[model samples]
Target: MTEIPAVENAITIRDLVVDYGTRRILDGINLDIPAGQIMVIMGGSGAGKSTLLRCILGLKKPTSGSINILGTEVNGVRARDMHALRKQMGVAFQGGALFSSMSVAENIQLPLREHTRLDETTIEIMTRIKLDMVNMLPHEHLMPAELSGGMTKRTALARAIIMDPKLLFFDEPSSGLDPSTSAELDELIIMLKNSMRMTIIVITHELDSVFKIADHIAVIGEGRILETGTPEQIRASTNLEVQDLLHRKARETVVDADAHLRRLVGEEE
Candidate 1:
C-alpha cells in the first residue's frame, strides 16, 4: 500500500484566546493553514474571525496559547523580529483601506519603500509588476477615491502583493459589493493562489466566495472554531453548528398561512 504525504502548514494556532474587558472574543482557536493554499475563515458577526487574524498578525496580543507563522513563534518575539515577521505578511482590509491621498502607484510603493533599500527605479518597476499582477496596470495613476469599488479592491490587492510576501490576509473581501463584482474578486483570489504560491487567510461570511475559493475552511461560532475542513467536508459535516451555518436556516420557524401556502405550492409545482 502507498502512503500519502503529509502537507506542510504555514500558519498554526493552538489554544488561542483573546479577551476584551469581560467578554472573550476568541475562546480557543486551533487551526493549521496549509502552505501555498487559501484558507477561508467563516462566521457570523462578532464571532472573532477578525480578532484571530489580528492576533496572528501581531496587532493584538493573545491572552493564552501559541501562534506560529512560517515556523517562527509569534508570542514574545522581539520587536525587530516581529517587524520582520510582519514583512512576510500582507493584509487587505474589509474596505480597500488604500490611502485616499496617494495615487495607486504610490500606495503600492509604500511597502517597498519602507522595507527595502532598492533604488527608486527598481521600486518603480516592482510597483508596475504588482499592479499588473492584479490587472490594475492601467489604473496606476488613479487615486483610491476615484476608482470604483471593484477597482479599489483590486488596487488594494496590488498593494498587498507588492512585497511578494509569503502570506496574505484578507478581511471580508466581498463585503459591500454587488454579487457579480464579488464573484470577479473571487476569481482574482484564485489566480493569486495558483500563480503566486502564497498562503492566504481570508476572513469572510460570504458563502459563495467561500465555496468558490477556499481550499480549506475554518468555521467559527460563538468564539470558537466549530469545524475545519474542505468545502465538501464542511457541506457533509454532521456538526450542528456547521450545518446551521452552511444552510443559513434557523432551527425552527412558524410561517404565516399565505407564505407557507406559496412555498409549498411553489415546491410542488
Candidate 2:
C-alpha cells in the first residue's frame, strides 16, 4: 500500500472574526485552502463572504483570530513583511478594477513597472506573454472603456497573473456577464489553475460558475461557515441552508405577530 502525502495549504485561517462597531460580520471562520486548487466561497448577500475575503487579504483587521497566508501570519504582520508577501499574491476585484486612463497592455504591465526595475523591453515582453495567455493580445492597445465586459475581465485576469503570483483571488468573477461569457471565463480560470499551479480563491454567488470551476466549495451563512467540501458533497449536503441555497429556496422565517406589532409601535419587549 502506498501512503498519500499530506496536502499543503496555501492559506490557513483559524477562528477568524471581524467586527464593525458593535456588529460582528464574521464569526469563528476556520478554513484551509489547499495549494494549487480552486476554492470557491459562496453565500447569500450580507452573509460575510466579502468580509472573509477582506480579512484574508489583510485589508480588514480582524478583531480576533489568526490568518496565515503563504506561511506568514497576516494578523499583526509587519508592514514591510506584508508588502513583500503581497508581491506573491494577486487580486482581481469584482468590477474588473482597471484604470480607464491606461491601455490594456499598459494596465497589464503596471505591476512589473511598479515593483521591478526590469527594462522596458522585458516588461513589454512579459506583458505580451500574459496578454497572450488570456487571449487579449489583440486588444492590448484598447482602452478599458473600449472593451466589452468579457474583454475587461480577461484583461484584469491578465494583469493579475503578470507577476506569476503564487496565490490568486477573484471577487465575483462571473458577475455581470452572460452565461456564454461566464462559461468562457470559467474555462480560463481552470486553465490558469492547471497551468500556473496557483492557489485560487474565488468569491461568488453564481451557482453555475461555482459548480463549474470549484475544486472545493465553502458555503457561508449568517457570518459563519456552514460547510466546506467538494462540489458533489455540497450538492448532496443535508444542511437545510445549503439545500435552500442550492435550490434557490428562501429560508423560512417564523414571524411573531405581537412582537412585530410592538416593534412597529416602538415598544420594548
Candidate 3:
C-alpha cells in the first residue's frame, strides 16, 4: 500500500485575536492553509474576516496569538524581516487599488521596479508577460480611469502576480461585478492556482465564488470561526450560523437583557 504525503501549510494561525479599543474584533482564530491550494475566509459584514486578513498580512498588530506565514512568524517580526516576507506574498485589495495615474503595464511593473534592479527592457517584458497572463496585454497602455470594472480587476490581478508570489491574498475579489465577470474572475483564480502552484487566500462573502474557487472554506461569525471545511462539508454543516450564512438567511439577534440594560444606563462601560 502506498502512503499519502503529509500536507505542508503555507500559513498557520493560532489563537489570533485583534481588538480596537475595547471592542474585540477577533476572538480566537486558528486556521491552517495548505500549500498550493485555495482557501477562502468568508463571513458576513463585521465578522472579523477582513481583520483576520490584515493580521495575516502583518498590516494590523493583533492583540494576541500567532500568525506564521511562509514559515516565518509575523507577530513582532522586525520591519526589515516583514518587508522580506512581503516579497513572497501578493495582495489584491477590495477595490483593485490600482493607481489612477499609472497605465496598466506600469501598474503591473511597479513591484518589479520597486523591489528589483532589473533593466528597463526586462521590466517591460515582464510587465507584458504578466499582462498577457491576465489577458490584458492589449490594454497595457490604458490608464485605470479608462478601464471597465472587469478590466480593472484583471489589471490588478496582473499586478499581483507579476512577482510570482508564493502566496496570493485577494480581498472581496468578486465584489461589485456582474455575474459573468465574477465567474470569469473565479476561473482566473483557479487557473492561477493551478499554473502558478501558489497558495491563494481569498476573503469574500460571495457564496458562488467561494464554492467555485475554494479548496477549503472557513466560516466566521461574531469574531469567531464557526466552521472550517470543504465546500460540501460546509454545505452539510449543522452549525446554525454556518447554515444561515450558507442559505442567506438572516441571523436572529439574541440580545442579552442585562447587558443591554446596563449599557442603556451607562453602567457597563
Off by over 4 Å in 3: 249-269
Q: Alpha-carbon error at 99 in model 1, in Å?
A: 1.2
All candidates: CA RMSD (Å): 3.9, 7.2, 8.0
lDDT string for model 3 (145-252, tens) is: 999988988888888888999999999988889989999899999999999999999999988888899999999999999999999999999998899887763222
Per-residue lDDT for 82-153 in model 1, tens only? 999999899998888888999999999999998999999999999998888777999899888889888888
Per-model TM-score on C-alpha atoms: 0.91, 0.91, 0.91
lDDT of 2 by residue, 1-269 (tens): 99999989999999988889999899999999999999999999999999999888888899999999999999889999999999999998888899999999989999999999999999999999999888899889999999998898899999999899999999998888987988989999999999998999999998888999999999999899999999999999999899988777222223578887898999955
TM-score: model 3 vs. ground truth: 0.91
lDDT, candidate 3, at 83: 98
RMSD of 3: 8.0
Clash pairs, model 3 backbone: none
lDDT of 1: 0.89
